[model samples]
Target: MKLKELIFIATGLLVLTSCIRKEAPNQEADILRCILPAEILADKSIDYSLPFDTELKAYPIYIEVKGETNLSNLAPQFELSTGATIQPASGSYQDFTSPVYYTVTSESGTEHRPYAIIIRYKQTEQIPTDYHFEHVELYDNYYIFYEETDNDGRFTWASGNPGYALTGKASSPYDFPTTISPDGYIGHCAKLTTLLTGSLGEKVGKPIAAGNLFMGKFELLNALGDALSATKFGVPFYHRPTQLTGYFKYQSGPQFYEDGKYTSNKKDTFSIYALFYEKTNEMPFMDGHLPANHFESPNMVALAQLDKAQTIETEVWTYFEIPFDYTRYNLPVDTDKQQNGEYYLSIVFASSKDGDEFRGAPGSTLMIDEVKLIYE
Candidate 1:
């Protein structure tokens, strides 16, 4: 063996080792960057639950991290309990094959948050699906509502519970304006009723609450920031809605008010409506506070508004169905949004039709059951 040749090979190996040492840590050093923002879980592309170590099983979660494609690049630094451990540890990669639960250490190392991470990737269907609102669980008195997924878990059902929670003051499910009713034509129904806010509400000119449930989330942080901006509505729906069918019983409260001032004696009327919108492909979501000018939105693809005459206080669970009135169509009539489903479907229910503007009676109520989406 030539000593000169051997020396050249050893030098090359040393250079290669140095390069690998420099690159490996760079790829894995972003442990802090990989921590998903709390908002990412709210979007329902993933699922999250509380109370770690529950027997109830959750699966197929995809944790979303902005700008980083490889989740394994940065692992969360979690201070676990006795015998609790985070897979792959900090600064490692892991496939979210199951739920991840841990007590996250505070930046100052003084405080911690216990979280159980679960994800059920919503596989977008090319066909129409029905929402019966039969499945519900009590979480924070908000009733984390969802439908069963094919994998035996749940697909996320976003609601306006956060809006009510802003005023709930730790109220129980029974006390919430939106609660699951034991009575329904099928299993159980959603009951939405207006609540009279006491002194705290009076100060902010928010004296009454019109019960509401929608297909999207309620931005609680923004609910008080701007009530109009609080309601983030919609779901990624592929099919254009032909009609919406559901049973509802409504009764208007006697006195009407606007902005904490006595306005009129008009009866409060319930509203059941759906918005089919072609969202910007780049942004794919309608931010909170959009329902204020939804009708005039550039995203308006279709709208189905219930007739006021049909929502009288029947008290008997009456049936009602309304079809979509397409003011615009970005796609052809016979198609779904599967070519690139960049649309959001929002089905909204409110005790008072004008309640979005804070102009409704305090005691108005609406009970909804067996809601289904009929599509083309």
Candidate 2:
């Protein structure tokens, strides 16, 4: 059902009704919901980075629509990448040895956006020996993980960079709370910080955002509609994990706020946990629903959670280890080589454990270093 075609059918039926009363309700549709690349992908496996680039040998793309689509009969159209051929002929394919550009036109024909495409391939070992967070790149003054050299850019981590941008804050980079701390226990380490939402966020009930570094892409559409749904967690990992160990230090901020109210007695706690799960054809990744829906998800294979009760005010880094308890969440597992990329694992550490619900204090900090993932 193309959007405009559906709209015509709907409008024709409405006209036939021939309401004799007051002027028909204004036919105008809402436009605020229009956004870029509602969904763009070649396959379920390839990750998308809008204004995205790829290095795959063969690639195809798909795009969908949202909002005001019912207002026009025109089909969504594409400006195929220059100089390259595409599969459907109307679409695109590019050599991408150099950068490429493309555009998509809305069905309504009133709006359009250009997308930059880059195609350069670099291969990498499925998993790195260690993710020291030693190598980093700066974007908007915030640091993003770039651990190794590969054609694809070896940043396996994802943060709330895009959501924070909505706050209209010049310091939005800090909102992602991804920074390089020189005081790392080792040479350099990853630092994740939570930030207070700016004026724009408070208007929407999202008063604050947790500092999160997870293993998958963040969906912008979900971020706008529901914050929880936006936190898509986990990336495909083939190997079975035995243990997760890391060093961390956390300090609590002075005040606590929740749902537009202040509380003096309540103190925010931190959360550090790992989720190991299966990726069947049905279930792909966990999202913001994890807190409320985790137990019901059939894909849960194992879960390991850090159980620190209070903030450790110590100046020195503290060591903690959480052994994987697969049976606690799901049935026993077997080692299968074919299972590669069929399972997903994610480790998350937060300064405010309740930050997911938009509750937390400012200045709360958590520092981690020398993390190790031991597999059996």
Candidate 3:
């Protein structure tokens, strides 16, 4: 039998023994005995971070019952109070860890149990500031330009568009093709991990500390507020003078992993960084925005004008954009397929000047999957 049931039987047996032994006056004393309340196994105090961008997150709390009982149909209830007022939980999960009091009543006696529970919120913070970045080479692969064959092939911009075609590798000659520009603008891989030469002449993979994801642009516009030039000038411009714009998304940095194990030691805080450049030495053409900061672009046409440069650190979840002024960085609306000159994309990781020193980057793999060239 369960502990509660066994206790009930034991209590009944004691009462029967007392009645048969009869010392009539002792009957009152025999029925009067102390009954302790059940014990809740879970701890009362808990600690945890709040969720990101949320009001309150929920978790489950556990309670266990034990010991002597009576009153046959005894029901268990929990009360919440701060020593001032008492209230009951709609249920355990209904109001987890809010304050609570547990009480059990029996025909023989009454027991009141006290308890405390801890509630934790998720981590919600603004984006970070400093970060280092690098760009993936667009020409790492190739694409087929065009061909005539079977009559069943339907061509969209994604499949090499109108008259010609290109494969990812063969199409490398053109920075951004018309087919991939609108929705699939630019694609490049950024590395969150880097190799560093230690003082002892050993090369080590140092993780990028803490930082946010960022994007920058270089716009080429005209006097009529129409579409103009951008990094991917291979595709023909529909408008005589169009505006160019660029976009990308970001998530928080990863936790530090050292020697393949996660360590809470102080040696593992890292950050990510990113920036945009016209050429290698020019001032950072576009700087990223932090979550705490306010950011908005005045025009939509400028996305195509940007050539992205990005980085990562210890932070996560940040997005940014740069506006193009036709007056500066005059971009070419037409093709720049001169393919002879080499363009550059550079990336680097900055250690926490005062952060963790773990052996590897916590979450240092950069993924650049989407590429697009927008016309609007």
Candidate 4:
């Protein structure tokens, strides 16, 4: 019984080993972190500061300096994905007046990703208060809304279209959550529609995308992994805004979905609000996560938000005005900090109020037009 039984056991063990699947090698080639040394931006005369750690996550990494700083020759440090390498090797001097492209290759050599580095001088420019929603342009295949400043600088509005593009469900500009609408109180308007994200989004636990427009930048790198933090809110503002006035038309979707499931008790609602906050080295800006509180933050000085009672479902163009409630923070606005561009203002519009949490109705729509900010 010994030899035959031993051979049978060995055969069974071999079969079991063969059935165990081998995991695939890591193929990600991404720049996880980037930093510029203080020596490169040292200036005693001008108020110069190093870039924030969070700003490195942008697609085209932007390094902002307070005053004129030499960017022709500089070195940068980068932390890449495990077993990945970047060419023009990290910590090497390169001209950054224009964008410098670096290519990263994966451990398996199956993936190659390109990253752009841009150096910009920090300048405070007050955005125009009036927003007529008349200008738009196409990028890649989707529409982008932008406004022209008095100084001829263009201010582009950010949306979740880029994140939705990852799902491969959008075939045209209209397929996106944000787009332009011909129907407006005047010539045209910004139309936001909550849309289904389909298979890929379902797999990632984000089944729907709410139509959103905001004064901020969308960090695409963090879109899929951490959507809440991907939306970097607020831009530098020099004026004191007292009120926000706008006209909108809203229609809720037939079915409400919460946490990716159908819910009969809830109805979809729209969101329109403005945030004014003091920017410091500690707290540069806010995000969808709202780390301090769900909607309140210690840094926030004032807020102008549309009340839920005022956001009724109406096909007609309805006018509404909200005043900035500065009572939240008893401290008065610091005139010195305001003049130094240490304050920021952000206006946000969304078809679904709880969209960032992946809860909304697919067909809910909110059309916004003629938005204006009244200054004190």
Candidate 5:
């Protein structure tokens, strides 16, 4: 072969190698969805599918049973990322009375992810009044507030901390949007602060995270894709609430930000409200996307919301009381449904009033303590 021809062949081979190196391998090993077969469920009519938390890599399945239900030797199906495989195999029977751990291997076999499958029995329990903002625990380096019921039952408060964890900005429990503060009206209180979610949050169109505490669960499955729908609000309540009273201290951040930009004219505000609504098959629960008519929704039995004027920035601890207005509701309260645990009530608090729209000022803080719900 000619010397020039040999050199040309070598150059072509070098270009081909460079192209191969540029193509990176996929490293995603995640569970997209989980479904439990109807045969394993005590109530065949109930859906036993679990919501997947991408950030936490866990599936918390709640099953409704009349009495004790068998959780052992039950196969659960899982839908995983493309080309990913789960150990113990999908649809393979395994004990689930206790949490079961599963490991997933990526298609490229270069990465692995561990997931926890937690099985919980669903039960309706009435919430206690007069929260002193006391009980809290640390989970995966983040603060989780919970309440101890009179019956020795534990009720955990849901917050935006788990969703904020997806940003990978928080370093400690205190760094999270929702956390505990030592400076309470009496003891430790629940502190909510709006914080910037950094580049990752901006990329997903959620530039800021507002500190919030609510009665229901935070569905992180669609958090990155649809944040508004991720917040499943309300829990079953048997009693009727008349008023909501609470003590709070608030301080708005220096600059208000909206849609990832600073808005000079806008001032930050806080939100404190409680909703009493009917739980029907059509509308099982409320979410961050509140109805346009607000209290006019047919499902809304009553609402106790702090007035906008009362949400102004205040350095001193302020006590506020709001009465639930049931007059706006056209239908009479169904005593049968209330006793059957068909009614739902949710009390929500947030650092920024418009946080659900991804508009808020970072550093805005709201500390809540001594919350009580007056019953009828």
Candidate 6:
């Protein structure tokens, strides 16, 4: 190569090297200077059973500066992406309260990618206050009583068993191997609505008769209908009473009997009930379907109404009663007082089987109204 060309190429390479040197140092400075708050394991792995103490609503958090990069004159701020709060750090370590959340900010008075920490709280034995529905009655015994009236202008029909929606009609089951359409039993329907009342003692020891065979516990029937057919000398399983919580809205299960059953010629029996569950979408903590079980939380009973259009509204009255024995079953700390734990209510139904059998058809609608919690 010519000497002139060689000199020109060398000069160009030197200029390029200088630019690269400047850029590399700046990049290195960022890596060495950035500050991160703290880190914790992601939520799905968190065990909810750890011990914890009850605080107001929020917890205080602190963070320690990890490196000697000297992040002085800057304060750190943290935020949860959802359902969490953070107070100003009073010290070097970040402190956090439950429930868990995300994100932390630096107090450098500048906007940069903020450091983050995973905050976790150990669960504690502080039992939460519970809501109990102690006593329930219909209309304070003023409006209508089932025993006094023969029919009371009530009927049970199966509008495809599942019944109708507010705007559009949904498809429900019909003509199953043991199913019928739109049950219209007089005595059975009365029993269904009647199951929503009475003293606390009657429901304590064993399961009782529930509402009509066509209508089931609200817990089991939140958004669907049911059908049943049973033969009876005593009560069949389908006619047994069930228990449910207040969260349930509607349900239907029907029953029917065979011919030539009872010697004395007694009619069949049927019912349903509502019970409570501790966790949402999990097995019920206490279910009325099985048998009478002791519980600390009071149960609520509602008097609801449903129009022919299947629109339901009912006024619910609450009662608070502590069981004679509440120390068992690891109940909440305070049951003697009213406002301690979450109150729950159960709705139940029942029925009896005789010599012959009874049958329940579809399209039976039960409407509840104005259900409210009266906390003490």
Candidate number with greatest TM-score: 4
TM-scores, one per candidate? 0.71, 0.71, 0.19, 0.83, 0.77, 0.22
Candidate 1 lDDT by residue in tens digits, 1-376: 6999999999999998877442221111111222444543324233222122235332122454433233333344433333333334643544444556444444334444445444333445532355666778776566766777565666655555666666655367766667677787678888888877667666666667777887766656566657776676777777667998988887778788786677675777888888887766444556444556546666677888888678788778899889898845444443444434557788888887777677788788798888888885
Put down candidate 3 lDDT per residue, 1-376, tens digits, no spaces: 5999999999999998877652322111111111223343211212111111112222122232222322232233333222222123323233433423333222223323333323223212111121211222221241222212135431111111111111112233332221112221233322222112122212223222221122322122210121111111112123322222223333322444454345565333323222112222232222222211211222111222222244233133333332333443344433232121111111112222111232443333332223222222
- Model 6 reaches what TM-score against the true structure? 0.22
After TM-score superposition, the amount by which residue 165's alpha carbon in candidate 4 deviates from its true location, in angstroms, is 2.1
For model 4, residues 266-311, the per-residue Cα lDDT tens digits are 8999999988898766777688876225567778888888998999
RMSD of each: 15.6, 11.4, 28.4, 5.1, 5.1, 21.9
Q: Identify the superior model by TM-score, candidate 3 or candidate 5.
A: 5
Q: Per-residue CA lDDT of candidate 5, range 341-374, in tens?
A: 7789899999988887788889999999999999
Tens digits of lDDT, candidate 6, 1-376:
6999999999999997877442221111011121244442111122121111123222222232323323333333323322222233323343333222222322331322222332433221222122121212222111111121133432121111121121122222211111222221211112122121113312332112222322212121322221122110010011111222222123332322223121233223322223322211132233332232222333222211111232222222212121222223334423322221222333322222110112222222232221222222
Find the 10 residues in a row with the least total lDDT in model 3: 156-165
- Global CA lDDT computed for model 6: 0.24
Estimate, for each residue in 1-376, the C-alpha lDDT of model 2 and write its tens digit: 6999999999999998977776533322111211233333212333343323233222223232222232122222333322322222232334333434444444444444444333222221355525676876655445566566344547556667667667766353444655667778887877766678778888877877777776766776666577787877876566788888888877777788787877898887777777887776566678768865644577788887776553455567888888888877665564562253557778777777778788887667778787777876
Model 2 misplaced regions, further than 4 Å: 1-88, 91-101, 106-112, 115-125, 149-153, 172-176, 294-296, 309-311, 334-340
lDDT of each: 0.63, 0.62, 0.25, 0.83, 0.82, 0.24
What is the clash count for each candidate, in the order shown? 3, 1, 87, 0, 0, 103
Which sequence of candidate numbers ranks them by lDDT, best first? 4, 5, 1, 2, 3, 6
Off by over 4 Å in 4: 1-27, 39-59, 82-85, 106-110, 221-226, 291-294
Q: What's the residue-level lDDT of 370 in candidate 2?
A: 79
Which is superior by lDDT, 2 or 3? Answer: 2
Model 2 scores worst on lDDT over the 10 consecutive residues at: 27-36
Clashing pairs in 5: none
Error of 3 at 238 (Å): 16
The parts of candidate 5 lying over 4 Å away from their true place are 1-58, 68-122, 291-296
